[model samples]
Target: MKKNTLFVFALFIFYFSFCLTTVAQTRSREDYEKLGHVVWEVDTKEKIVAITFDDGPHPVFTPQILYILAKYNAKATFFVAGNKVKRFPSVLERIAKEGHEIANHTYNHIINRNITSSTLHSELEQTDEIIQSIIGYKPTLYRPVGGMHNDLIINTAVKNGKLVILWSWHLDAEDWKNPAASQISRHITKGIRPGNIVLLHDWIGTEYSRTSQTVKGLETTLRFLYQNGYECVTVSELLFRSEIIDQDYFNTFPIE
Candidate 1:
């Protein structure tokens, strides 16, 4: 009788531990769904990545950047700030005219954590209005400043009929602080993978001289990605890949 009681207690403990582990795994999956950011990482297999430029449409740098992209037959996504668009309407038009995808980076580039709902809405709406006025259509994608967003931000964007675009990898070029061109290039070459959304800036100040270094680095980075079988694409294309992944996940799970 004593032996049977001890055996039962041990089995109970083991069952409880298994239950806990299962619950933890389920919770992790739920958390990942909630975050819903970084739909893919660039790798050799998928052979596609996105180069995204933020905080732009400045007078000096944007044109030069566009020129370089055109030279390379590369298309990129530009998440322009609303204030900058208002200040440089022609620049925004030129970006749209040049065949690059334009996205919202908010009217003021407000950090989601520090902003209220009304403020967030205002930022998005005002920027959308300005961009639509310039481009004749509002962008359906919004990338929050610094790629920092919460549930509220995502929900707000969805309600406004926009998708929140977040990056999968960061090069940390720190162009604002003037990191060396070699350093920036190295970071990108080493970090790039398939399905990656790389964050870069086209404008740092009024001069736009910083872009010269970035452009040089881009040449090297592009060569590396191309050699490794990675194709550069726009944000819309990358998002489409992510949607396919989501559908696969749902099909596999088949939630009942």
Candidate 2:
């Protein structure tokens, strides 16, 4: 009887997990926009793309990524964690000095979905304070760690005066896994469109140094954009070029 019951419980858990995945896969971008001031991509026709990096300010990889950006004359956004900022202030300073957008990714890189409101607020506030101390201003953008968020996360971020920035659903380079540079570059350059935000990582924590692969991939991706006549700009620049401030601006377009 005990064995039979355990089998049933396992089946129940599997079913529940499958249902969650199905719902996430089926939800359209329009559905996500209804949640809050969330931005996945800018609605525009200009030949521009926003290349954004997350979990950065690494002393080694961040500078390498910056060097490549400079070589290509491209501007990208960097979403940094507070703990990292404290550890690497000079790297953070260089990111700002090099003319890239610096946004918050939380204090400790927390990704718990059931995080309490107070904890979430502290995470954001602490990161904001750290970033402002270095950059002289609080960032207007916040990306939840692991790209996971909910109503509470969205509401809290909005209350704190930030737009929850996410990448184009199709532009995730998945470099954290240490994929080859060629695969990373192709995933971004293929089917590339205007106002698309490309997600890359300049830091993947001390456990691994996968960003070494990312440094190679970035140059190839930038070269493809340059040759294709696409300007690589910051996320804020992309938003301004699209002129989309209203939260409902996404509703005007058909679901992709």
Candidate 3:
């Protein structure tokens, strides 16, 4: 009788542990699917990656970067701030004209979590308006400021017909802090992988003359990706190639 009771208790503990683990895994998968964000890498058996530049449409750096991308015949995504769009409308047109995808990076580039739903919607909607006015089409993609996203922001974005894009890899160039271009490039090259979304900035400090180092680093990074057989593409193409569901998963949420 004593042995049987002990055996039952041990089985019960094991079963409970298994159930918890199963629940956790299920929740993780559900979260990944609903977010529509890149959570895990897909084994496509081909070397491909997406390069994205955010907080841009700057007067000096943006044009130079576009020139390089055009010269290489490479396509990338630019998440432009709405205020910047208003400041440099021509740059926005140039980006669309070059065949690269333009995505919303919000109006003021503020932390979404700190803002109310109405404020968040305004940020996104105004940006979309600015982008559409310039590009003649509404952008379908968005990247939250600083890659900081939450349930509220994601829901708001989905309701407004935007897909929240997050990077699988980051360059951490800290261009805002004036980090060296070589250091940024080295970080990216050392950490480069298939299906990676390499992050860089076309916007820099007021005192900076030109992003010559970033341009040089971009050249080096592109050459390395090419040599490694990785085909750089836009974010949408990457997601489509990976077969992410098109239907909005957070549609039930309110837009504003």
Candidate 4:
């Protein structure tokens, strides 16, 4: 009887694991479709660009980034993590106080794509609340960790009133790898054009040497945008160009 009970327990574990995996994957294909359709870039003829930093509000690195942006008189968006904001409310305060946009990057920077429903729901709310507490307003933009999201995650966020933000593939700076700042500057400014959204990481969770390198590269990048006559604006402002008057924010228009 003991052996039979043990066998049943193992079977139950297998069944539960299978169900979880299936649920996670079932919405994934639909999620991929919706994800591709979401705003990857905006249509505008203005010489303006959007610079977005993800996974940030780091106590040290974030302040460094803010200094560079302020020096150049540029405006950009920060997609901050909830837990990070909780620990570094002052950093978020400085971001808002300085006139930069703060958006949601999730409460915990979960890289795993197979997140449970409860975890996804909690992540959205926790981060939103933390940001609201710090900035006095909830964010309307959400960028998933590493740009990974399924149908459930997208629908949940949209239902909760967030327009998912995804960057163009050709425009990523990939500073998370800690390459020389010169390399990062080139990746972003090379062939950079209007209405293009460039991705960079401000907070990589640890205050590493390479992370500092990304910060170092930021000045050169802002300089490029400044000299090139491209106005560095928040992702929301990028959509606010004359052709698209007003904050056409969280627009459901997909890639044509």
The better candidate by lDDT, 1 or 3, is: 3
Q: How large an RMSD does model 3 have?
A: 10.0
Candidate 4 least-lDDT 10 residues: 24-33
- Give all candidate RMSDs, comma-separated: 10.6, 6.0, 10.0, 4.4
Candidate with the larger lDDT of 1 and 2: 2
Please tell me which predicted candidate would have the highest TM-score against the true structure.
Answer: 2
> Tens digit of lDDT per residue, candidate 1, span 69-96?
7766677899999998989999989988
User: How displaced is residue 121 in candidate 4, in Å?
Assistant: 1.4
Q: What is the TM-score (0 to 1) of candidate 3?
A: 0.79
Which is superior by TM-score, 1 or 2? 2
lDDT of 2 at 153: 71
Best candidate per lDDT, number? 2
Error of 1 at 89 (Å): 1.8
lDDT of 1 at 24: 15
The residue-level lDDT of candidate 3 at 166 comes to 71
Give the per-residue lDDT of model 3 (tens digit) for 1-256: 9999999999999999986664312124357555454233343655777888888888888898888787667889999999999999999899889889999999998974445567888999999999888889988888888876656666667778777777764545555555666776778888877777777878876425664467667877777777777788888877778766444433444322
Candidate 1 local Cα displacement, residue 245, angstroms: 8.2
Relative to the true structure, candidate 4 reaches a TM of 0.82
